[model samples]
Target chain A: MALTSEKLAEPVAAPALAEDTPSVAIRNLDLAFGSVKVLQNLNLDIRQGEFLVLLGSSGCGKSTLLNCIAGLLDVTGGQIFINERNVTWAEPSERGIGMVFQSYALYPQMSVRGNLSFGLKNQRLPKAEIEERVNRAAGILQIENLLDRKPAALSGGQRQRVAIGRALVRDVDVFLFDEPLSNLDAKLRSELRVEIKRLHQKLSNTMVYVTHDQIEALTLADRIAIMRGGVIQQLDAPQTIYNKPANLYVAGFIGSPSMSFLDAETVESGGTTALQVGARTVPLDGYEGEGPLAPGRKVVFGVRPEHIVVTDAADPAAHVTATVDLDEPMGSDSLLWLDMDGHKLSVRIASDANYAPGSTVGLSFDLSKSSIFDTQSELRL
Target chain B: MTDATATYTGPHGPKPKRRLSPTNIMLYGTLFVVAVYYLLPLYVMIVTSLKGMPEIRLGNVFAPPVEVTFEPWVKAWAEACTGINCDGLSRGFWNSVQILVPSVILSIAVASVNGYALANWKFKGSEVFFTILIFGAFIPYQVMIYPIVILLREAGEGISAVTGTNFRLMGSIWGLVIVHTIFGMPILTLLFRNYFTSVPEELFKAARVDGAGFWGIYFRIMLPMSLPIFVVAIILQVTGIWNDFLFGVIYTKPDTYPMTVQLNNIVNSVQGVKEYNVNMAATLLTGLVPLVIYFVSGKLFVRGIAAGAVKG
Candidate 1:
């Protein structure tokens, strides 16, 4: 949370874009395979020198949208613009973008150097220039020692570096990566992820990355577009999306040890707004929203595990009393699952604070960091 | 307790297998029988070709020649008669060479490009085209022989009418080469298509994004990685065109008859003294080209065909 908060501060302190033209734009894009619509009327704008990540679970059309932007999949309708040009019908190569695939996709017959230079040779680039570019990309990726080795001789991480170098040698203005690190083990994935972020800082080219991993979306993206069922549910800076999700789905999808919910009804007594959960009345003094909460509205009170605190003293007016059901001790912290009159809720606490089963505890909700959602619309109130 | 301890030994894997186990006996015994069955004819052909005519008449066919002579090989190469020509199988050998080289090259080149296009650069009617081409593979050559003959005859007549010259494919070496090439296309195309299909689609997509068009991708990427399949195609075409007898007899006349047809004529001429040695020598010569090719590239052939068997 501290790391995320620090990153959240820097972008706000920075100035806005000097020019508003997006490096890549999609307008009413639609893609279909025969009768099955994979994407429909989707629109996105990627700013210059920005790293935009399309994040979702599997079959969420995030990869499909990235493919459309890369000019790999032909859109069934609408247009795509790159650098202000209408490149709806342009070939992938002509779109001024370089793409890395999940499988590394290096030519198995060619050495690493050959894999980087094959496309340039096809373009008929001057030999000296091709050599220089290949050398520079190899140096940047730190794969110069592997230049003579074929792809089969390299390990998974080294092969991926070669793949990125292949894209780097193209020297295009935009890069599209499709789960490029998913093939590696966890340690290498994190190492490569940092390198990719460093590469973005050095080159400052627009990048559109597609992945199903939420952590990758959180750490690397300037803006994250969360997609579900061919539609973008939310798009915002990672911190904004994490703290103030626009809908119930976004709130639930963003966090690990996901947010806990309590079924409640809003109450207004003497101009003071509050929520009634079972037998307890929780005050809504610090709850921030677009407008005042209406009385008698059925709503879901959502609070993340880390936002709930367990206290020893039970003050019925301020805290909900619950019995601990189980505690899972993760290395850094433990999640305490509690049963409050048959409603299950989880609270995050330090690993040293072990809670035995059936022990009573008072749970204090952080109202400022919690979300209240309308039951019918599923939107945050 | 003592018996159990005696049998236990230390914890280890199963006992080492006996060399002469029942399974090994059955496997090697069957393989040895099949090997002998296949090699017996070749052994007979070699022994029969080395025997003098007098030795063959006086002894059993299986016996080694009491008097070995190379006269039959020389006669098969220079003195044997086919139809009315005293010239031996050398002329037919040259004709077969001319037909085999062009046909193998043309068929493999065209079919590989066809496979590359069908597998990667798919167009509007590509699947339909592929279905039709694969359909052609199942039709028997015997059923299409007369129709092909008529087609070649008509082509020759049309060319003659246009050029006012005696241009004919009906009795020429080129005619047989075309026939061999056409016959070889279906199976060779299938082999190449299956191989290229197994190449990762991402590699093809990466190449397309890297500014490589069809030929560029083929030569720089697909072609180089496809050496095994190319070797497969070459072996298939070489063997098919080299051993062909029907097309050689039907498409070309005496001056351009292929080695197989010449071998047939020498064996069943119905006029000579039935020189079994000479007949065996001619048969061995006719079969030598494909045998030599198979032996030289035998390992690559297995590797190539096995590429399509298991896909990652």
Candidate 2:
């Protein structure tokens, strides 16, 4: 099977704690819509100047969490703190947070300059300073030429940049973005994604971004909070999330051509436990060595597709041998689909190799980076 | 910079260009027929207004006048009488303007307020108040005139102590203005409410986050979006209040009666032989303000409001 390389990283189990105050902290937050509980006991703390991204599938309460932080919603239970202030009961304006909506919520009647200066006007800023900030933000976004145009006159990308520019002019402590690049096309989405990261780097304020796109979350976030069913399954740096996912759900998420899983058992050899799949055994390596793993437990083998190597010549008694079913060669990286037993697995191949679709290739499973997980809880062992 | 202008094809492709066919022609023909059916009465009113009483009595209502004369126009404008005042339809013109102006202003103002409250703010009686207001709108104007007349009499007598008999609101121009404003309410609120609801919740959120208070959002965001719908609201209120007959007759004094009230009196004057030509002219002339408004701003009038405030 073809394998793609993944960057190694230290554990990012918790966010970086600053000596100063946290920008936003929500404690034991619970929210419900009608009768449905959307967020259950969500505890989150974001440090100042950290670009935190809520990475999850749709309906996973990422946007809900952003709204909660922005004071746009009332929690069913719990309090929210912004810049060390208890802002749970406060109105959105009092929160001192600026938000960029997915729909680019620029006022249609207002010009680009008006949009950037709108918040400042509301705060009763001086006319000169308002113009200065608007000009500066427009310059940063490269929308100075279009300042006189209404939102309807601007393109989708221009509108989003203006939305961001509006938030930038606020010059507040926190910047919250709810999938700001979603309205733009793929090319625009990537370009705006870079712009947001650069903006975050420049502004150095606490930023919380929400997106279902893993690529955006992975590239833009300082630390990614992977959510599922209103609960944060794992919150870690992107490298940690990609290399060592906290659980099966996280392993399944966070990576393109996702990590392949094989139902396995823990087999001991010389006081070391190796994960046993069908007719194959692989080392548990760093995880098994670090944590005390019980023998004979049903463990799931988790290995990234990027780590799987599809070779013509194979060494005897390799980790796992699976027949390659399909191969897709992307420009920078290729994807290889392998069928092991009944489960069809995806393997990320880093090169555009001239490989046929149904070639029966041997697999040398990379043991140093494999994950062993408990079958019942799906937690990494 | 290279990727800035790159475009991706959207989900659905562009639609095929349209071409008119025979079925389209048939549909348009049917629409034309329906339009003529609606406009036939207006045609008769004009045709009969220009004809002499002899020609009108000949019963060719659809036929054009043989000798088109504007003598009836002069008579309707200058010589019709209402209880010894022979100042014609012009007698009620000033009173009608007074009633129409104030009623339109007051009703438009109240509707904007009610629409703002009902759409965004949800106080205790908000929904119930809206329900009652809408119900009042749908209720026939005839059903409302009784309570209104009684209320006006009580109110006028209360104020008569100060202004004496002449300035009494019961049978004066002010009474009719109040009646027209009250009648204008239901539809105005409903129109603004529906229009406001269509606006994105995100726009409201942006405004709120921008530190705009309750009234601020309504005025700055909601009111500024008064486009197409403003035209709609004005036209609806203008037509309804302008063509108002029952309220004008019931509430107004004999001296302060509007053109519709005078038009009715002229047709039913029963002073020897009824002057049909002058009656027809007066009827058409009384309808002139709205008709001219429609002709001039007809596109906007058909748009349903007086102002195009909610431009997209």
Candidate 1: list runs displaced more than 4 Å.
A1-19, B1-14, B310-312
lDDT of 2 by residue, B1-312 (tens): 658667766755777655577888899999999999989988888888898888888999899999998888899899987778999988787778878888888888888778777777667688788889889867887787788889988888877766675446778888888887777778788878777766777888788788888888877777777767777767677777788888888888788888788888888987778887888889888888887777777775555453433332
As for candidate 2, its interface RMSD to one decimal place is 0.9
Best by TM-score: 1
Please, what are the lDDT tens digits per residue for candidate 1 over residues A1-381?
433432342311222332789899877678998899988766677899999999999999998888888787889988899999999999998999999999999999999999999879878999999999999999999999999999999999999999999999999999999999999999999999999999999999999999988899999999998888888777789988888787888899999989888899998866888998878788887887758888999999999999988988466544688999999999899999999888899899999997889999888899889999999888888
lDDT string, candidate 1, B4-95, tens digits? 55655586788788999999999999999999999988888889999988878875878877788999999999999997898999989999
- Candidate 2 per-residue lDDT, tens place, A33-147, comes to 8689998666677988989999899999999999888877788987899988999999999998999999988888888888888789988989999999999988888999999
Q: List the residue pairs that clash in candidate 1.
A: none
Best-performing candidate as measured by DockQ: 1
Error of 1 at A260 (Å): 2.4
DockQ for each numbered candidate: 0.74, 0.60
Work out how many backbone clashes candidate 1 has.
0
